[model samples]
Target: MDAPRQDAWKDEEDLLLATTVLKHIREGKTQLEAFQEVAEQLHRTPAACGFRWNATVRKEYQKEIQDAKNSRKATRTIYSSSKSSDDTPMSLDAAISFLKEMKTKQFEDYGKENLETQLKKLNEDNEKLREELKQWEAAWNEMDKLVHWVREKRKSESGV
Candidate 1:
């Protein structure tokens, strides 16, 4: 029992969504990211874009999706191997994918390094906090002992 949507997707919008999704796949980005990008362009929510893609557009682009994944794999292989043939000229798609792959690697490395540094700082802070807590606990125990001793001495002196 769903209400009818006021605005329907046009053919061009569907095409745009399809192509953007395929391009994102080839570039090693997720479909949700593609949906967000297309949503911004189409003035729709990402959920709407994702629904439209899965419900309608995606069925038509199955082959393209496979091709995009293969292209991404190929791009990775091309960049990872040092033994590519110099006689063979690289296509524009391959060149662009190569650059994208490199950029993705740099971003991943930076993220890992940044996370390690944060973890080191957090561990140091945690150790400091533990030491501080132990010191406070020792001080509290000493204060408790002093209070008990004072009360016992007063009781002994007053014969209470």
Candidate 2:
């Protein structure tokens, strides 16, 4: 449960995480996406960001979170009544408008450096996962071999 001293979350970083999460909430995005965004900016893992939020930062931002959720609900209500269904593709104009809206909310808030950080984090995570998968596979193969040996031993003992 203890974070390394060098990886401690600072006040500014906590504030950044909170605000980013709130904005994502207002935009109707998942908290995990917010954690991923903050992970890059904070140079930490998304899981770390999420843990910090749930364990400490979230308590301080309850009111803001509620407000963001309310705003998101209102926005959804406005869009939900539209004739266009999810199965149908949006028109080019609608797509443009949606992207523009997202740009105003996002590009103005986060700097260019954040994206490079996210990509770096993603690469690191990918390598870590690959290594972990290899370890698990090796252990599984060993277990399979042991089980096969045990079964053969039993069969030989039974003269089958």
Q: Top model by lDDT, which number?
A: 1
**Pairs of colliding residues, candidate 1:** none
Estimate the TM-score of every prediction. 0.53, 0.49
Highest TM-score: give the candidate number: 1
- Residues 5-84, model 2: lDDT tens digits: 98677899999999999988887678999999999987899999999999999999999999999987666554444564
**The 10-residue segment with the lowest total lDDT in model 2:** 88-97
Candidate 1: worst-modelled 10 consecutive residues by lDDT: 85-94
Error of 2 at 83 (Å): 10
Tell me the tens digit of each residue's lDDT in model 1 across 1-160. 9986678898999999999999989977789999999999999999999999999999999999999999889877976567976666666766776787778988999999999999999999999999999999999999999999999999999999
- Deviation in angstroms for 3 in model 1? 12
RMSD, every candidate, angstroms: 8.8, 22.1
Error of 2 at 36 (Å): 0.7
RMSD in angstroms between candidate 1 and the native structure over all alpha carbons: 8.8
In model 2, state the lDDT of residue 129: 100
